[model samples]
Structure formats: structure tokens, C-alpha cells
Target: MLTGKQKRFLRAEAHHLNPIFQVGKGGVNDALIKHIKEAIEVRELMKIRILDNCEEDKHEVAEALAKGARAELVQLIGLTVVLYKESRDNKRIELPKSK
Candidate 1:
């Protein structure tokens, strides 16, 4: 689990990133989770865009994506979601020690 500081840092780091994946007409699915899991493993932090035609609320989609990928929802802005997950093999973005 991310501490407040870790989440803050991740949010800042993800600010300029463009969405690496788009949730389209199909919405969140097994394929989407698979791709998100892979992307998070590589990038540690990734942004996903909910396409204009997506029927679900942006945050609702973000929550589902986050849960499906076992990732943290750092921030959701407009139609975009920023998610983070520490890689077991290619680990990055170490969390700070909690007090």
C-alpha cells in the first residue's frame, strides 16, 4: 500500500505522461487488465484514457481498472486515470517507511 507521500510523488511523476492505454467500447475486460498489468510492470506508473464513448463514469472505470490490475489509483483527471504498481521483478518507485 502507498503512503500519502508515495501517492503524492506518483501523482506528480504521472502528471505529464500521456495515456498509454485507452478504455474503448468494450470497457475494462480481461484484455484490458492484462495490458494494464504489463504496462504497470514496465513503467511503474501509467495513464489510461477512458474514450469519449465510454458509458461508465470516469472514476468508476478507474476503480475497476485499478482493481482488475491490482494497481493503485493515484489520480483521475477528466477522462484519464493514473495508476501505479510496483513490479515484483522490475521493481521501481519504492515506498517510504511509515512512521
Candidate 2:
């Protein structure tokens, strides 16, 4: 879960990034989730794009991905999504301490 401030920071960090992955007509599969989880562990933050041909709504896809990967949905804009998860071992982005 992200606070508003944290989400804002992540959105800015992800703004210039291209989609590292795409959810196509097939939608979010278990295998896809596993791979995405790995990528998130490494990259910390990444962009995902929903294909124009996708029949399911964008929020549905974002929710599915978040639920599948146990990650945070930082933002959803147009067809894009930003996801984040702190790696226990490979931890990267050090968030500001919250009192």
C-alpha cells in the first residue's frame, strides 16, 4: 500500500519510462504474474500498457495484475499502469521514513 505522497513520487519516477510489459488479448496469466513479480523485484517500478485490442477494461487489468503480483498500483493513466513492490532481498528505492 502506498500513501499519496509515495504514489506521487513513484508516478513521477515512472513518467518517462516506456512500458516494460503489455497485457494483450490473453490478459494477465499466472505465468505472466510470476515474470512480472520478478521484474518488479529487480526494477522496483515499471510501466505496463494495456493493448488496444484488449476487451477487458484497464482498471480490471490493473487490479488483476496488482492482486496477482501482490504489488501496489501506483497510477493508471490512459492505457498505462505503474506497479511497485519492495524487494526483501534486492531492495532498491529507499522510501522516506514515515513517522
Q: In terms of lDDT, which candidate is strongest?
A: 2
Candidate 1 deviant stretches above 4 angstroms: none
Per-model TM-score versus the true fold: 0.90, 0.93
lDDT over C-alpha atoms for residue 44 of model 2: 87
Give per-residue CA lDDT, model 1, range 39-71, as digits (tens): 799898999999999988888899999999998
- For model 2, how does the per-residue alpha-carbon lDDT over 12-41 read when each residue is reduced to its tens digit? 888888998999999889988999999998
Each candidate's lDDT (Cα)?
0.88, 0.89
Candidate 2 local distance difference test against the native: 0.89
